[model samples]
Target: MLDARAHPSCISVAVSRAVGEAYAARNAAAQINCSETCFVLAFVPGDLDGRRVAAALEEALEGVPVFGCSSAGQITPHGYETDALLLLAFPKAHFRCSSILFEPLKPLSTTAIATAAQRHEKTFSHTAGWHRLGLIFADGLSKQEDVLISTLETVLDDLPLFGGSAGDALRFEDTYVLHQGRCYGNAATLLLLETDLPFRGFGFDHFLPGGTPIVITGADPDERKVFEINGAPAAQEYARLVGCAVADLSPQIFAENPLLIEYKDRHYVRAISDAGEDDALSFLAAIDDGLIMTLGQGQEIIRTLQSGLDIHDEQGRRPDFILGFDCVLRKLEIEQKQLGRAVSEVLCSAHVVGFNTYGEQHCGVHMNQTLVGVAFFGPDQRTLY
Candidate 1:
C-alpha cells in the first residue's frame, strides 16, 4: 500500500477571477509543481469563450492531457464558488490513467451505456489492473445517467466510479465537455486509474418521505416522462397530495419534494427534472409501479456532511485529497441553510478539494445524497505497494 505520510501526492488549486492568459499561467504553475505525469483539470469560469478558454487551458498546461468540465459550483479548502477553477494532481507512478469518451448521447438507455463502458474497459485494460477506482464525469446536459451508470457497472465489475457532471453554473443552457484539449457537447468521460494507492471511499445523502410511499404504476423513461404513481397520474396525484397545482411543479419544487422510490430496503429519491403537460412528471431516474415514494427534502445536508466526515475518519488513511460528487440540489440546500462555513469545515477537516456536479456516480452506478470520494494515503508511506 502507498504510504500515507512520506512522498505523499501533493494537491494545490488556483481559482482565478479570470480564465484568460493571466489565470491560466498561475493555474499552470500550481499544477506543474504538483502533478508528476498528469493532473485532472476543471475550469468553472463564469464569463469566458468556450473555444478560447479551452485553448488557453491547453496552452497553460503545456500539453498535459486535460479533461474536465464546467462546474455548477466548486468546493475547495477555502469554500464553494460559482466562478473559479479547481485542479488536482496525481504523481506518475502513483497512478495509471485511462479515459473513455462518448458523444451525441441522448436519454437513458442501458444497452447504450453498457456498450460505452465496454469500450472504456478496453482502454482501461492497458492500466494493468492497477485501477484503484474511477472518476467519471459527463455533459451536465445529458439526462440518461441512470442508464449510463447501470451499464458501466456490468463492465467495471468491482471498481468504484466517482465524479459529477460539468455544471454550467445552473444556467442549464449551454454546457461544454473537455477532452484532450477539445471541447464538445452531449458527451461522457471516464477516468480509470490503476495504483496500489491507499485511500478510503464513501458518500452520503438523505431523503425524508413527506407522504406515504406510492408504487410506480407506469413510466416512459425514454421520453423522460412518468404518467402514474399507484395507478394514478404521477404529477396530478403528487400535486393533490401537496396541495399545489400540477402546472406549478417546477425543478426547484421537484428538488424539495422528489418522488422517493423504494427498492430492497433502500429508498432512492428521484427529483423532478421536468414537468410534462397534462399531469406528467419527468424524473431524474426511471419510475416503475410498486415502488413506494414520498416527497423528500435537503434537510439533512448538515447530517450528511457530518456522517461523511465520520466515514472519512474511519477509512484508516491520511487523505491527500477527497474527490467529491455532489448534486446541484445539495448546492441549493447549502444556500438554503446558510451553512457555507459548516460545509467548508468538513472539507478543511478532510483536506478536500473538489467540484459540485449535476449528478454524481459511484461504482458505475448513478446516485444522489451521496458524497462519493477516494481519500488518498500516499504509497510512499504504506506497505500495500
Candidate 2:
C-alpha cells in the first residue's frame, strides 16, 4: 500500500520472499524515495544472514537509514505471513527520527538509561501542536525489557511510548535489532519521533478475565518461571484447568486460554510461552510468586479491534496509517480459529503496518498477547495544517 498524498513525507509498504531473488527486497525499498526504511525479515535458521541483507539494503537505498528486526510473522496489507520481508518507508518532510542503542542490556543501570532518555528528550522542540513518540525495538530473549522500559519511562515522563520485542520466528534462540547496517544482540534501540500530525498511542488485547483466579504459589521471579500454582505443578495445574493434559498443552492451547494480571486497575496478559521438563510454566511477562492471575477468554477479535481504533478517530478524522506491534500469540489464535481472512480485512481496512512480536511494551510495562500501536492522522487534521 502507498499513500498518494501531496505531502512531503508519504509512506509505502512492500513485501516479497522469492527464492534466489534476494535483491528484490532491497529494490522494493529504493523504488519508494523514502528517507528512512524499516525492514522486518523472516526467521529462517541458517538461511538468513543479517549482515548480507543489511549490506544489500544499504547499497540499494544509498544514504537512507535502514532499521527494524526479525519478526515472528510479518503483518502487511494482504494479511499475516511467514518467510516474507516487509518494509515501511518514512518520508523526510513530515517525520524526523533519532535513535539510541543500549547494549549489554541486562547490566545497564537505570541511571544510565534515564540519562540517555533525557538527552534524547532535549533534542526536540515541544511545539504546541506537534506530536512526539518513542518507538522501541528490543531483544525478546534479553529479559531486561521490564527494567529498561521502567527507567526510560521515568525520564520520558509524559512522552508516549510504544513498541514490540523482536523475535526469531518461534525459534526462541537469538533475536537481533537492526540499526543502520549492523545487528545488535542483547540490546535495544529507541527511535524518537517528531511530527506535526495528530496522533494517539494505544494498546488492546481481545481477552477478558474468566473469573477463575489461579494463585502463583511458587515461582522464580527473576526468570519468570512458575513452579507451582495452587499447590500443584504449574504446567499440570494449568492444563487441568484448561481441560487438557500437560503434554497436550501447546501454543494453540495457550493462545485460546491465557492468564491475566490486573495492575493499577488495568488488566494485562501473562501469556505462557513454554513448559519446562519439570512441569513448570514460563511466562512471556514477568511472573512473581504471590500474584493472583485469572484465566482469560478470547473475545470477538474483529469487533474489538475496530472499537479500539474508533476511540482514536476524533472529529470524523480517521488515521492515515498505523504503526502496530502485535503479539504472535494473538496471531496463533486467529489462525487456529480460521479467522485469518476476517482479521486481515480489519488490519487492511485500518491501514496497520508492523509485525507479530514476541511481546509488547506500553506505558513502561512489558505485556503479552496485546496489540500496541501509534496512529498518525493526516496532516490536514492538524491545526497548523
Candidate 3:
C-alpha cells in the first residue's frame, strides 16, 4: 500500500484536549495515509509544560517526525473545535521538514525577516527551489507580520506560504511554540518540503463590502497600530459606522463587520483583534496611511462554504490534506445559529484536519473571515477526475 504520490508525505496535527483530541485523531488518520498514531496533546491551560509535551510526543512518534503548536482553537472535518489536543504523524520520506524559530519582532525589519526566512528555507531546501510549500507558524502577538511576509516573499517568491499564528485558546497570554519536543515563547517554525507539486490556496467568502471608503489619517507603521481614521480614532469611526458603542467593541463584534482595505486595486479585509487605548485599533494585517478602507460584507451565517467541494470533484483533484485557517469570529458566527455541528459536518465531509487560527496567512499575507486555505492533492490521488 505504498501510495506512489509525490504530494505531502504526511501531516502532523497537534491540538489540545479542549479541541477534542480523540476526535481530531480520527479525522486526521482518514485525511492522509498517516503512519501508526498521532502526537497526542492535552492543553492544560496555565500548567502547560512544553518539555513534558514534546518529550511525550517524541516518544510516541517513535522517531517519526512531528511538528505543530498550541492553538487558540482547532478544526477538523467537523469545523471549529476547542479545548483539546491534536497531532498527526506523516513520514519524512514523503515530506522533507525543517523547523525554525524566529523572535524579537518588536524592532521588526524586513531585512532581518528575510535573513531568517532564508535560513529557515535552507533548512529543508537541502535541494534548492524544489520545495512544494512552506508551512509557517509565528507568534500571533508579534504584530510585525508585514515585515515577516515581505521578507519571506523576497526569499521564496511564488513559493506559496500557508499557515497561521500560534494561538493560546483566546487567553491572549503566554502563547507557545513547539519544536523538537520543546515549546518556546515568541518564536516561529517552518515545516518545509522539497517536492515539486501542484497546489492552489483558494478562498471564497460572502465578501461584498458596502463600498464606502475611509482613509487611515493617523497611525504608527512600526507598531502596526491604527489610531485615527478620517479625523477620529479608528475604533471610534468604526463604532459609528457599525452603530455600536465604542465600549461595546471587541474582536468578536469587529470580526462580524471587518473593514476592507484596498491594496493594489483589489480589496482585502483587515480583522481588528484588539481595541487599544484612545480609540486605537490593533489590526491583524497591515494598514497604511491614506489607504481607503471599506466596511467588509459577509453574512454571519454563510451558506456556500461547501460549494468548493464541487470544484474538487470537477477539477479531477482529490485532496491529500486540508490546512484550514478559520477566523475565530467566523466560528462565533456559526455558533450563534447553533450551526456548529452542521459546519463541522461540511468540513469533515471535505476531509479537513487542522486548527482554528486567531488569524490566517495566505501567500504570506494575514487575513480573516475568508478561508485562506490550501488543499494538497497527492500526485497519484488527484487523478480521480
Q: TM per model?
A: 0.83, 0.91, 0.81
Tens-place lDDT per residue, model 2, 196-314, is 77777889999999966889999997788999999999999999999998889998999888999998899999889889899999888888988999999889988897887674454
Ranked candidates, highest lDDT first = 2, 1, 3
Error of 1 at 70 (Å): 1.9
Where in model 2 is the C-alpha error above 4 Å? 1-9, 20-24, 34-47, 124-129, 382-385
Q: Considering TM-score, where higher is better, how would the candidates rank from best to worst? A: 2, 1, 3
In candidate 1, residue 152 scores what lDDT? 73
Runs in model 3 with CA error above 4 Å? 1-51, 119-131, 195-198, 313-315, 381-385
lDDT of 3 at 210: 88
lDDT, candidates in the order shown: 0.65, 0.77, 0.62
Model 1 misses residue 127 by how many Å? 7.1
- Tell me the lDDT of model 2 at 264: 88
Q: C-alpha displacement of 151 in model 2, angstroms?
A: 1.5
- Model 2 global lDDT (CA atoms, 0 to 1): 0.77
Q: Show how many residue pairs clash in every candidate, following the order shown.
A: 24, 0, 23
